[model samples]
Target chain A: MLGGQFLETAIWGLPIVIYPFLSGLMAGAFVIDSLAHLFGFKQFEPVAKLAATSSFAMVLIAALAPLVDSLQPAKAPLELYFRDHFPYSPLSVFIIIWTLYVILMFFEMYFDYRVENIEKSKLSGIRGSIARFLTFGNNNISKESLLKDRKALFIISAIGVPLAFAFHGYIGFVFGAIKARALWTSSVMMLMFITSAIVSGAALVTLLYVIGYSYYSKKNVVNIETLNALGIFMIFAIAFDLFLDFIDKLYSFRAYTEADVFHGWTLVYNAGGVLFFNYFVVQILLGLIIPLILLIFKPVRTSKLMMVIISIFVQVGVFAMRFNTVIGGQLLPKISQGTIIPEFPWLGFDGILSSIGLICLSIVIFFILGWLFGWEDSNKNGFENQTNSVDN
Target chain B: MSYRSDFSLKEADEDCNQELLSANFMSWLVKSIALGLGGLFALSILNSSDSADATEKNNSNLPTGPINNHRWMGWENPVLDDKDGWNDWDKLLNPKNLPVWYDNFHEIGKTKPKHHWVMVIDTRKCVGCQACVIACKSENNVPLGVFRTVVQVMETGSMESSPNGMVVTDDGNYEPNVKKFMLPRLCNHCDEPPCVEACPVKATFKRQDGIVLVDYEKCIGCGTCIEACPYNMRFFNPVTKTADKCTLCVHRIDAGLEPACVTSCVGRARIFGDLNDPKSEVSRLISQYPTARLKMSQGTEPQVFYIDLNGNLEGNTSMDKVFMEYTYTIGFNTTAYKKLGGEVDLPKIEEHKNPFKEFEK
Candidate 1:
């Protein structure tokens, strides 16, 4: 609550929070995709293709969220193109990693959809023509070529796992490395960010899988085992995330705000505080606790409908975590004991409305990618199986 | 039988509605109490923690791991990296090392600085005139609200209104218990600036002679630097749409003139001069006085040394109206803004249905 020389308007606002959450979702989805290809988790097989597609869509949207947050969005390209962009700056590191990662994801998706693209090229329709153009005419559908595609995707996922971690870790470091901020200075910030990212990513995949499968399948009954595995993965992620929270909270006890107030106790956990609700209720209780409790019961985890609801709660929880870390960190000024109000502009480019628009844009991209890639055909995905035989 | 059935159905609807309402109220009560208990528990913990001893001083045990790793990271400033990149701050604090401090600064080919700039603020002499504040605005075209430099009045509770029937005068010290005084505040232009490193684009850079400034063209206004600055010196300029901060009046310094704020300082409290020349007034005063810096433990190593400045600046105060009138807002104080020669016209206030409109004549 250091009310010193505080800004009238919050500079980071909702966009900053949304940017990190979206990117985290991207990274988390990448992690799930990799779990099947890289880590040999057969349970994650069902969601791998969906995860990759979602990851690609999210990366684009997450990247744009920052541009919206920047005052001079036009100059954002200069971050990469500008000569002597400071190499060590977290933001600079993020841009380079993000670019490389996006390209790698594109390649992975290209390979995933390559076989399908070739199959469609034989048909007589606009989608087939479009598929032919998308394939770039190297459409060798021989058994060896399918193996080669699988090998390529395998290597890409391997490389992408660390890159994905680095990409998301950079966002955490961007705030965590700031020596001036009391709340953001903890050593565990990056780890916490990564874990929470996995939680949100896993949850979103679970939600989409449940909903998407029902939409695509004639029978309402879906893969209960996959949903259970996702729920288990989420529980572990949330538990790890909560443990980090515990450590950070205890460490903050030692830290002091610039205003001579307790940094952790006053701003973070104080009951009447705005940060309190964001941290405890939205983030911990409804987001993590209740969801965790529901998922622990065998009855809830086995049910697709219940898993969907839990996934929603997890996304909301992770979102609150980001909101708390970004906006809540800036609310308390460094000068003295008081807070600046975070007046969320519901309109304007930098407002909450714009963030909602960006999210919608991401969903639209997901739908477009699904249509373009012919993902409605269940046999088209599943990287390992697709390489085994050609679908005629 | 039909009449009895209708009556029973109506009774069931009423019972169901009442049950739902009670359930809603009960859930709300349970949730509120749960959250409230967490807050109360937190408050009690805070109280217990506050009663701890002297180690609870501000910035004690401050975390500075990333800042301390410049040498390890091998990311030292290329120009000064080999021999003079890092300085032992404790060594520089000694007056005997003043010449050494000036020697290594800014040695680029044929462009080495002759004078190392430092500004010393004497808090005892500040009268809270608001002249420096106004002069800075007029000189820099600073917008209606924010200040590049402003004087803050720290009221020490020891001050008495009319103690011992002694009358307070312009030049007289009437009350011995009085501690009310003005402490002029501005950017310290820190040696180990956190803002410079945090800036993603390196838009903010520290000059050879200790002046840290922002390159407006490169700044994307990510506000990373704004958060990095512990002193709250950096701001977003609405006109430029980039990050802005106090530049130590480098333009005027190059022009062989004092800063607008320094030139207009009536009390002569602010003395800016070269640390290169030991005979300079700034060097002499700094050597003589037991000077102190704010939040020194944060390790920014602030360049502005304050004399007779007690570190008890009480805060959590509301923003003053003048400070509240930032340019990014829909409207601002026209009367106050005109003083600074603001050009923007007043925006039309969106009419609202007044709650007391019914009583209007």
Candidate 2:
């Protein structure tokens, strides 16, 4: 690679990529959950428990990516917190927003699982005793109290959705705010991130909803209408996301805007480069377009198998977009004329292995929470059979 | 009962589907508008973060040293003049307005500084020597693969009409007719240093004397400062796990001696002095002759000025010339100094936790 003098060797590697991918899924899933609780979309209610629980899990894992990425992982967050920080710095603001969002997620899950906890408290053994403890002494499962819980859920969803947006949007701002990097200086970065978050999050929730419902009920049949609704959201979200990327890239060209100082547009546009493959081929073509096409057809949208495949592609695209932003932006030297190729981080604390570990950890946590609280059983007995009553 | 999963979109009445569609449309309409508005609000704040009117500069949020009056370091700045330009409807096309490039002397601090530091380099007089670069390394104890200051050997004109002709190396990719000049670069210690603004943890800050230093204990080793510098002066210190850069030899300057680089310049190409004191050599040289600074378009307000530059610094990024991707950097400087019969053992300086603590008698 012909790079200029002193290309930055401390390139932020794959951990930063996983950070946004997970956070987007976190936010996007919560937004989908909001359609039912906040907006009274009854058809979406069956998937609500699955979406919210998965969102909670994503947040837990997403939080780890940055901590692992920080230079002094142990010391860095303390300084960012417990010490003075500039409001202009997005990282400073994100910590506060993230904490609030985490608290919000916990409350949302509590209200979501409250009735099940009340019911489980009646059974014998340690599980019953644990459920009794989680009920917080208010064992009432009356309609009024449940309606009150519904109102509370609505409020939590309202705040949760934007807080989720803030969490993911702040990540975008961390890159976009840097005026020197031509590739990331796009004003539309936050919009692109939010839109893509919706796309990926919806896709993941759809996939999880289909898969989780089937696994929990020990049946292949699930709610087709709810799956179609998620699919519709996925299609629109992906379309809007693609439009944002188009605008971001189109204006980033030197011909369109003055901010493309080092020809960041050219690097991504260059057919010969890795960034071009990440941005154009994997991110735009496979990740977004393919998923959008797959989700658009009615048969595909309703088919549980097809939904899972499209969601995976959507995730791939979102991850590639993040890879393009964080890694691609660092390829060119700030002071020199040439480009620097980053060594792939296959090993290390924040390497690809740790990322895979983090994902597996989140999945483990998700199931443990599911087993302890019976999130699957609640969905199955409560809303599951009723929603599944409709023919596919 | 309403919260229970009794209602499905099986559309009860014939009109129910239409009502549901309108309600969903309205829900999306409100959300889309909210998202759009939130984005605009964010864009407005971020673009205006560095605006001039952040007077009293309370928002900078640096923990140590009072960085008050240094916000734009007084109104000789192009960026400050356009502070209100963000509100103008015509200027809405660009909220992140670009700053016009210009140069002027910034008095070091609000209260008169006991000593105002400044540097003026005579690029014409520089003999492409490695003296200053070697002295700085040994004095600062800059680790391997990095340097505090460097003399960038750059070229002008085409590969043809070459001065040295094609190198004796047969396969070398050499540009012909390219006239080479060496430009020495270190920390500019800008009046409104961008690194200070970029740090999230308030690790890097500019002192009253205009010497920018990193609080090593405070630094998170984020590498944002290294990118913020236009001069490429900052580097990640592998030893300390902190960001390292030229402090303009703040330690030596405090001891009433010249910087190591200044003392070692065989050609006396680098000049350093108190610019506030009009009788100083730096002040005299700047007033006497026309001088230019590198990358003024960046609006960092770099204090280092160059004389007889004569198109040496234009039409290129930092360090213009590249012969086999080689610059007379730290390793090469150490080798050249040894060839010139310079000694190896230079004293190692301890890292200062707080270099800019108020001067005590």
lDDT for each residue of candidate 2 in A132-231, tens digit (9 for 90 to 100): 5666656666667777788999999888877888899988888877765666777898888899888888888877777777775663347888888888
TM-score of chain B of 1: 0.54
lDDT of 2 by residue, B190-226 (tens): 8867777777787776666677777665677666666
**Residue B138 displacement (Å), model 1:** 0.3
- iRMSD (Å) of candidate 2? 11.2
Clashing pairs in 2: A3-A338, B154-B321, B159-B175, B159-B176, B159-B177, B160-B176, B160-B177, B161-B177, B162-B177
Residue-by-residue lDDT tens digits, candidate 1, A55-79: 9989988888888888878777765
DockQ values for all predictions? 0.14, 0.11
lDDT by residue for model 1 (B278-344), tens: 9999999989998888668777878888898765542333222113223332112222234446566
Tell me how far the alpha carbon of residue A356 in candidate 1 is from the true structure, in angstroms, after superposition. Answer: 1.2
Runs of candidate 2 exceeding 4 Å displacement: A1-7, A123-126, A216-221, A259-262, A372-374, A377-392, B1-108, B161-175, B310-325, B328-361
The alpha-carbon RMSD values of the candidates against the true structure, listed in the order shown, are 21.7, 14.7
lDDT of 1 at B273: 89
- Cα lDDT, model 2, residue A167: 90
For residue B314, model 2's alpha carbon misses the true position, in angstroms, by 4.8
